[model samples]
Target: MNYPEFLSYDIALAACAALAVLITLLLLKAFALRHLQRLADSGRLHILRYAEQVVSSTRLPFFTGVALLAGVSQIKLSPMQDRWINYAWVVILVSQIALWGSRIISVAIGNAVARQRTADPATATHLLLAGLAGRILLWSTAALVMLDNLGFNITTLMASLGIGGIAVALAVQNILGDVFSSVSIALDKPFVIGDFIIVDNYMGTVEHVGLKTTRLRSLSGEQIVFSNAELLKCRIRNYRRMQERRVVFEFGIAYETPQQEVERLPQTLMEIVSADYLQTRFDRAHFKGYGESGLMFEVVYHVLDADYNVYMDIQQEINLALLTVLRERNVSFAYPRRMVHVTHLAEPQESAGQAGKLAA
Candidate 1:
C-alpha cells in the first residue's frame, strides 16, 4: 500500500504536538476561567469579571482550529492547502474578536442599565437598545473583515451593499422611520412609560414604548396605538413631568350682581381657593370681562399636586364652596339669556298726520 507523499514522520509529530497544544489550551482555559470566576466573585477586582466573561466565551472549536493552524504552519503542504488554512485562521481570529467585543458591549451596557433601572427606567430602556445596536455593528464589521481577509473584493461588495441597502431602505422606509423615531424618543425622553401624554385629540397613559408603535391606555378603557414617527411629529403634552397643575377656569355671574359684591369677587375667589383643605396656590382671580349674557370672571390657580384626580377633587371643593358663597351673597350663577328691548313704531300715515298737525 502506497501512502500519500505528505504523510511522513514529521507530519506525525506535528499531529501529536497539535493534540498536546489543544489539550493544554483547553486545560488552561478551564483553570484560568475558574480562577477568574473566584476572583470576580470575591468582588475585589471589578475588571476580572469582564475578563472572565471574555475568556469563558472562547469556543472549543476556535481553540481546536487555532491548535490545528499552529501545527500545520510547522508542516510543509501544497500552496492551496496553506492558503485555506490561513483563511480558516482568519475566520477563527475574527470570530473570537467579535465575541469578545460583543461580550464587552453587553457587560458595559448591562451595568449601565442596571444602575439606571430604578433611578431612570427610561434611560435603562434606551441603553438596552444601544447594546443591541452595538452588537449588530460589531458583528457586521467582523464579517466584513473576515471576508476581506479571505480575498473578497470588499470595496466592490460595500458599493453593492450600499445600493442594495438604499433599495431596502426605500422599501421599509416607514418602519425605519418609526424605529429611528423610537430611538429619538428614548434619547430625548419626550415621554416614557407611565407618563400621561396628550397628542392632538388623543390623551392616554403611555403603556408601552416600542420601536414601531407606542401603546397608550386611554381613559375610555381602549388601547391607543400610534406610530412612533407620527407621535414625535405631533405636539406631545407630558403631564407626568408637571410638578403642579395650573388650572384656568371661567365662570359668569348674573348681570344683575351687585357692583359692591363684584368689586369684592376677586378677594372672595382668592379666599375660596386658599381656604381649601387641598393644597392650592392662588395665582390670581379677576372680573375678566362682561360676557354676552353675564359678567365673566377668570380665575387661575395651581394645584400643588400633579395627580389629575387630586386636582379634580380640589376643583370640586372650590366649586361647591363658591356656589355656597354666591348663594349667601345673593349672587346668582349666569345662564344664557337674550333680552330684547322693543320700541313701537307708528305707521307712515300717523307720522304724516302728526307732521301736518304740527305745520297747521
Candidate 2:
C-alpha cells in the first residue's frame, strides 16, 4: 500500500479500537451500577455489594490496558513516538498493577487479621492500628515499585528517603513519638476500646486510635482527641480491669444504746456482710468511735462485680438487710441527746430570810 493509504488505515484502526474500548467501559459501568441498585433494594446481598466494588476497581486498569494495546497496534509512528508509547505503557502498567496489588493485599491482610482476632476479640484501637499499619506498608510498597519501574536506582532512592525521613522525624519529633506510642499501646493492649479509662483529668472510652492522635468519647458524650505521646505521659487508670469493687460505709447508732452493744457492733456487721450474697466478702468492720450525735461504725466489703449499677444495687440490698436484722434484734440506731440539771433552793431560802427579819 502507498504511504498515505497506510497512514489512513492506521488512523482508522486506532479510532475503531478506542471506540470499542469506550463502549465496553460504559457497559461495564452500567452493569455495575445496576448491580448496586439491586443490592440496595434487597438490603441483604452484602456479597453482591462486595462483588460490585471489585468490579468497579478493575475498570480503570482494564481501560488503560485496552487503550495501550490499541495505540500500539494502530500507530505507525516515528521512533520517538514509539519510545514514548512504550514508556507510557510501562509507566501506566506498573503503576496500575502496583495500586491494585496493594489494595488487594491490604484487604486480604485485614480480613485475615480480623478472622484471627475473632477468637481473641480485639478492641477498636487494635483494629485501627492494624489497618493503619497495613495501609502505610501498602502505599510504601507501591511507591517503591513505581520508582523502580521508572528506572530509578532504588538503593540510592531508599538511602535518600531514609535521610529525608530522619530529617522530617526530627522536625516533628513529638508527632513521631505519639505515633510510636500509639503502636505501643496497640501491642501492649493496655486498654481496650470500650474500657473506661482515666488519664489525669480526662475520663473516657477510646473511640479510635489514629496515626497521630487517639480519639476518646467522654462520659459526657463529647469527643476528645489526645496525642498518644501526651496520653502515654499521663497516668492512666483502666476501670475495666477491676476485679472487684470495694465499698466502705459509716453508720451511726444512738448514744443511748449500751456501751457493750456498741462494742459488739463490728462483729455483728461482719456477720451481716458474710451472710449476704451481694457482698463478696467482709473486709473489716470497726466501732470507729463516738460521733457528734451517735456511735459510729465503719463497714467495709467487696462487691463481686465492678459494674457501677450492680455495685449500687448490691450495696442497697446489703443496707436494707442490715437494717432489717437490726430491727429484728431490737437494736435502736443512735441519735444525739443531752441532759440538763439545775439547783432550785433559792426561793425557799429567801422566804426563810424574810420571816427571820420580821421576827427580829
Instruction: Supply the TM-score for candidate 2.
Output: 0.73
TM-score of candidate 1 relative to the true fold: 0.61
Taking every candidate in turn, the Cα RMSD to the unseen true structure, in Å, is: 8.9, 6.6
lDDT string, candidate 1, 104-210, tens digits: 89899889977876688687778777887889899999999999999999999999999999999999999999999988988889887678899999999887777
- Lowest lDDT sum, 10 consecutive residues, model 1, at 1-10
**Top model by TM-score, which number?**
2
Model 2 regions lying over 4 Å from their true place: 1-16, 25-53, 59-73, 76-78, 109-127, 258-261, 326-360
Instruction: Identify the runs in model 1 with alpha carbons over 4 angstroms from their true place.
Output: 1-26, 59-77, 117-133, 183-189, 192-194, 198-226, 233-235, 246-277, 282-301, 308-360
lDDT of 2 by residue, 238-280 (tens): 9978999989999888767877777777887787778745547
